[model samples]
Structures are given as C-alpha cells and as structure tokens.
Target: MENKTRPEGFEQIFFADGNNLAKAHPVKQDIAKLKIALRQLHHNADLLIDAFIQRCESENVPVDCHMGCQWCCNQAVFASTHEMVVLVDYLERRFSPEVIAEVKEKARLKEEKLTELSPKEVLNTSLPCPLLRKGTCMVYPVRPMGCRIYLSSSEKSCHAKYDNPEDPTVIPKLFDFTLKAGRQLNEGFAASMRDEGLDMKEHRIEHILLKLLESPDKKNEWLQGATIHDNFPFDEV
Candidate 1:
C-alpha cells in the first residue's frame, strides 16, 4: 500500500486547484474531477521512486545526493502540461508576492540562457532553478515528479561521459537503475493512467513552465486556486 504523507501547507502543490474552479460552469466538472487521476498518478510515481531507491541499495551504488543539492534542479526535466498547471497553481497560492517576483526574475534570466532547440543544454547549464532560494528548493514538496525521482540517485550520472572512451570510469550505477526501472514502471504508468485524447507532445515541460510563469490567468487562478483544462478531453500530456 502507498504510504501517503498527510498533506500540509507545503504539500498543497500536489492537489488540484479547486477553490476557484468550484465556481466554473458545469462544463468543467470533468476537469475538476481530474484531481483524482492526478492523485493516483502521484501515488504511482511515489512507488517508482521507492523502487529506484531499493534498486540502488540492492546494487550498493554510492549516491552523494542530499538536501540543498540543486544540481539536477537546473536541468529542464520533462513533465506534462497538466502537471505544470497544477504546480504553477500551487506556487501561486503558496508563495508571497515578493517570492513570486523573485522567481520570475530568476526565470527571466534562465530563459535568456535557454534556446528553443537546446532545452537540455539550457537546463543542464549549472544554473540553479529560478525558484531555488539560499540552497533550498522553494517549491520543495510540490516539485516535479522528475525532481523527486532524481533524488534517489547519486550525482555521478549527471556528470557521466559515455562519449569519452579515454576517461577513467568510476561513476555510480544509479542512473542505470533509474533508467531501466523508470522505463519499465514510470512509462507504463504514464501510458495506462494518463488522461485520454490529449496531445502528449503539444506541451514540453520548459514551455509549460515558462508559460505558467507568464500567464497571469494561471498565476491568479493559482493564487485563487484555478488551473487550465482542455475544452475537449485530452490524455495526460
């Protein structure tokens, strides 16, 4: 059985934006109901993460991961637009205006470094996440699923170089476990539980995060507890 932590103020990011949406016309009822699916997804994602940790332990992989380690946080990890919408809404509600302004400024700078064609390069450029403040992820509990899964591994995978045959190799085997298990479990979950009919590729994570930052509707509704829903039912993106 999944051991779900009782959600707190910081944990609110995991849930749907219901306060404002409750007022929407009845047409959005199905969308509101999507919270249930998202919750299930989170539960499944948690299981995958547990499996990753267990794999690392079984293999005796040395992981140097810890809190305040923001290296992975810099990269542009992929996530569904649905996830981003939920994340942005939660941040809006939880963060103060000053915090939001600071985050936007950080994102603005990060955005300047990002090229549309090279998302990974931009994300992996060693710059901490725009929302990272004083060595802590400001969005901690509500952070993306990728961010959560990545914590179970060591930092070596982030620095490994399969391209350099001459380089002496001592990197931990954590990435291998995450890659294999992620493919087997996480991918399966996304395929089976995702909302049906949505164009999965239409929203890349970087685009969604950037859009969420800029969208006042999303920002406000987030503060007021609202998120975008597809007019037509769409699969999880």
Candidate 2:
C-alpha cells in the first residue's frame, strides 16, 4: 500500500471551499452486509477523490497521471483476502477460458521469479501485472483498495521510483487520509469476514491467483473457516 502523509491543510485539500459533504445511510441487515458496505464506502470515497482531483486540476495542480499509464503496473502489488473475492468473481464471470489460462501462467511465473530474488532484488523487480492488457487494467472496476487510491501528481517521479526502486527521494504524492479511510473501511470488512469465520489475511496478487486457479472452491472453503492451505501466502522473501 502507498505510505504517504496528509499534506498541509489536509481537510481543506479534500473538502475545499464550495465542495458539498456526502451523507451516509444505514445498510439493510443481511449476511453479506459487510461486503455491501465495503463496496458502498469504496464507491463513495472514489467519488470524493475524483471530485477533489478535479478541483485540484482547476487550480493548476493537475495530476500527471492519465489513462493507459502503466509505469506503476510493473511492481509488487498486494490485496487482502477480502478484496480477492472481488477479483476472483470478476475473472470467473468476465474472462474467457483462454484468457484465464494465459493470466494464470503469467501470475505463476511472476510468483516463481519473485521467490528466487533477494529482498533488495524483489524491491527492484518489474513485472507486468497478469491482469494488465496493453497498459490498461482489465479488471479496473474491481481493482483492490490499494490500486484504487494509488494516485500521483507526477509521472516523472513515478518513472523515477519505478526505475530506481531503492531511491528514497524520488517519490510521488499520495493523500494520507484517502488511504487511511479506505484501509479502515477494508479493516471493517475483514473483521466482519473473520467474525463469519473467513480467512482475511492479505496476500500477494500471484499467490492468491495460483491457488484459486488450482481449486475453484478455495474461496468458499476459506470463507467457512476451512484450513485448506498454509498460512503464508507470499513466500518468506
């Protein structure tokens, strides 16, 4: 996840002059309420973020990120067990069998390659995401929380950091409160799932995909508290 600080006057940045605040309503009580709430919260936050960015651009502080920019796609990305449901569901319903086969191999190869690298080497590793097709996210709508909030105002900085992953100074601006709120909402989702006896541990993209590819029922089993697999999702690298 993106580690960033709220810029000075953070509240103002998010809710500047003339920006109307959003109100929330209670959810209908149901077994899948948490998942529903998670989607609602994410959707609402996405709106605020989109509005905020629009206003920022009006003031000449436009974000350099545009569609089809895949500089950040070539790196390590993670998703929680809670978010994996969204991913797996999308793949099963939307992608064809041939597409699924190709992505499974791509994800498995990434996992194997990263496992052999040292910590430093892994940090500098660059691999196209299995879901990335020609520089666009195939599952953009159902992308994880981490992917949703990873915004930047500088494309040059993105390139710099992606090229020299070891550099501390070459960085991009990320909204701290945006990331924090999204994570807290996700935490609630995970907590709810755990209460329902689900495995809510975070996992790397490839590891989770490989397991799901092997067994289609893994999600259903894990949701019911089944210890079907080992605890470690990412290797000890």
TM per model? 0.61, 0.77
81-110: candidate 2 lDDT, tens digit per residue: 656665777787898999999889998899
**Candidate 2 lDDT score at position 159:** 87
Candidate 1 global lDDT: 0.49
**lDDT of all predictions, in order shown?**
0.49, 0.65
Point out where model 2 deviates above 4 Å: 1-38, 118-121, 227-237
lDDT, candidate 1, 1-237, per-residue tens: 012233344223222222112222122324344444445555655676677667767898655677655555655555654456667767778988788888777776665665443533442345557767887876665555566556535555644522221243533234544443333332333333223323222233445566677776653343233433222112311
Question: In model 1, how many backbone clashes occur?
Answer: 7
Q: Which pairs clash in the backbone of model 2?
A: none
